[model samples]
Target chain A: MNWLIDFFGNAANWSGSDGIPTRILEHLEFSAAAFLIAAVIAAPLGLLIGHTGRGAFIVVVSANAARALPTLGLLVLVVLLIGVGTVLPVLIPLVVLAVPPILVNTYEGVRGVDADLRDAAYGMGLRGRQVLFKVLTPSALPLILLGLRLSAIQVVSTASVAAFVGLGGLGRFIIDGLATKTYSDVIGGAVLIALLALAVQLGFTLLNRVVVSPGVRQVR
Target chain B: MNDEPLVRWDWIARNWDNGGPSAIKTLLESHVVMALLPVVFGLLIALPLGVACARWRWLYQPTAGLMNVVYSLPSLVLFSIFLSVTGLTQSTVIIPLTFFTLAVLIPAVVDGLGSVPEHVRQSAVAMGFRPLRRLLQVELPVAVPVVLGGLRVATVSSISLVSVGALIGQGGLGNLFIDGWQRQFYTPIVVGIVLIVLLAVLSDGLLVLAQRLLTPWSRARRRTA
Candidate 1:
């Protein structure tokens, strides 16, 4: 009971040198950068393979293989190679982690599209590109968005690994607190991470609701 | 690329003599020991909790929701929290890993129980079987495959996650990998990766075999001589 009182009373001590505000912003920035970069790279590749229906197995296998890499191991390797303190250590593994969900979702989404709708688009003399843009992509958007939601959540959680290499984020609090045996500081960091994960999950859930077609909602 | 020199293998060859093999053996044994307790402990706690949650409507949403939140947090963050509270030691690693396994195991159990056929529950009720009896005899048997599938995933996930414990100085195969990274010794890192991958595959295969053995009635039987 006294420990709780002391913890709350000394909350300011838990703030650390960069302070809460800067740390929060840095965490958000790192998450956003990793999510966006992974989405940009993976979404198109997924769409292409998904639409063509030729490389589905290859894409899935590659993505799964990438995911199997121990993220901390990869991060340590990257830090060793590039020297720590840059965003690359965080970004590289995050991209690797984020890609599998997007790629799998994209492939599932495109393949899940109605074949009859695709045939009708083809019969209308649309070029392959037009068919893809007009028919496949719109149909696949809802699922792709689902993938993005998952990717966003994963990237946000994984960005915590950045603290190991001295990159700034909410993880800094947790890591430093652990080293010093500061329970309140560790809890504060964990609370922040838990809250951040919930926020991302909620944010994406809203996005999913908005972007998902009414037809899909009806099916649900 | 051909003449670029392979750094990973060279390091392994140099280190094999100086307690490296024993270190590797200890690492493997410790990982299995660490992972085994949580999995067993989690299953023990979670199975009943899950069954209770399934039988009672009021407990379902809150219990499942709590587990989901725990599941979503990265293992590293959880380990850090545990370390701060408990101080760095084996318990620090064990407690968090166990908690994380609970997060997975509870849901899998609940989902498995939920997947049991409605008719089975109905029949059990008609026969006036007690809740415990119904669960033990009917629901659990029906749910075993799905639950086992979840356990397989949890086991694989735990193996991967246990590597992070190395960061806090708890030795495992991850220590090998991390040591390599710290000293720029590529060989042990490569070896660690290979070993981890092989472990994952072997564990997954064994789990699948276990599942098949346990749920022989669920799968189509092969024609035999």
Candidate 2:
């Protein structure tokens, strides 16, 4: 226990490239970048598919398939295929990981827009693009945010896998500690990751409240 | 000899047997034990808690809060925390995985029960069915399709997650990834990834079959639709 206190207490551990702060930043950067890419790709695609009602079968099967893929396996494969030491190995798998939740939720969210509401928009002389952005997107916002919440937290938790491939994140403390047989560092690392995850969860709750419309927030 | 580690046919062939130490077969055996045990135990524990939540209704919110905390926590972090308490052993791995499975299963099970149509319960009551008997005989049978669907999601994810336990030298098929990483060999890593996915797919198919076999009504409904 003293080891944990001492570990964090060291002012030196709070700054610099190898510091706790830096590692936390790295973890957040990885999660945010992957999430942004996934949302950009999936959310738009979901709107198109949900609007047209095409590719429902593909979306369902792929979402299930994506979740079952081993992160470590994908990590190693990506690194093997495209040589490691770059950030792509970690970033690519995470984008892949983040995609399913966002895509599925976005698709479901758009698909779930009330048919009457959609018909009302069409009757108003709204074209497809206007209907999607105005009607489906707002209606789907609650679920889209929910999907983002799930994806963000998941990517953050799993980002530690990057440490295995010789990248630094919050996982560095856990992975390196294990290799060095430093028990305290390992425990401390785990504790920090848990804190970060909880923070993300809490942050999402707040984000959901702020971003979602009051009428639809009741739906959640 | 070219060593040919990427497509190391000879190395892979030798390491695949059931007879050898750390063979793929042996790893898979241990993997099944470590992976499936958590989902089984999680089902046992979660189903009841979920039912309790369904009954109480108020319990759902708190139960969800607890499950979220568990689900959001990284598997690597959770395993290390257990490692400190249980020391280096399979129990350390199993305990965390059980919690992970619970995070998925409880919500699924609870929703499955809750999603049972209100009128169905009302009719069952009008038919002189007691609350307990209605739950067991009426609600449960109707709930099977939804519960089984949840189980498929929970179990497939569990199999993949069990591999994360390799960080502490405790996961089953994870040993392959670890070993391959150390040797810079691709054979075991590729085999491990491919096999775990196939296993998830196959298991998912079986569960779908279970849902079909158990819920002829749902299947018939689908047919009519």
Q: Give the best candidate by TM-score.
A: 2
Candidate 2 per-residue lDDT, tens place, A1-220, comes to 8768866977887899989999999998888898899889888888788889999986897688777888887887677667777898778888888888888888899999889999999999999999999888988998888788888887887788778987789999999989999887888888888999899889988988887788777766
Give the Å shift of residue B194 in candidate 1. Answer: 2.6
Can you list each candidate's DockQ? Answer: 0.37, 0.63
The collision pairs in model 1 are none
lDDT of 1 at A184: 68
What's the TM-score of every candidate structure? Answer: 0.80, 0.95
Cα lDDT tens digits for candidate 1, A21-124: 67888899988988899899889988899888887787757554554556666666666666665677668877888888888888888888889988999999
User: Model 2, B1-225: lDDT tens per residue?
Assistant: 124456677787888885976889988988888888988899899888989998898899999999889988988999998988898888988899899888888888887887789999999999999998999898988888778877888889889988888889887898888888777788889888888998898888999888888888987887899
How much is the lDDT of residue B191 in candidate 1?
A: 66
Query: How many clashing pairs does model 2 include?
Result: 0
Error in Å for residue A85 of model 1: 5.7
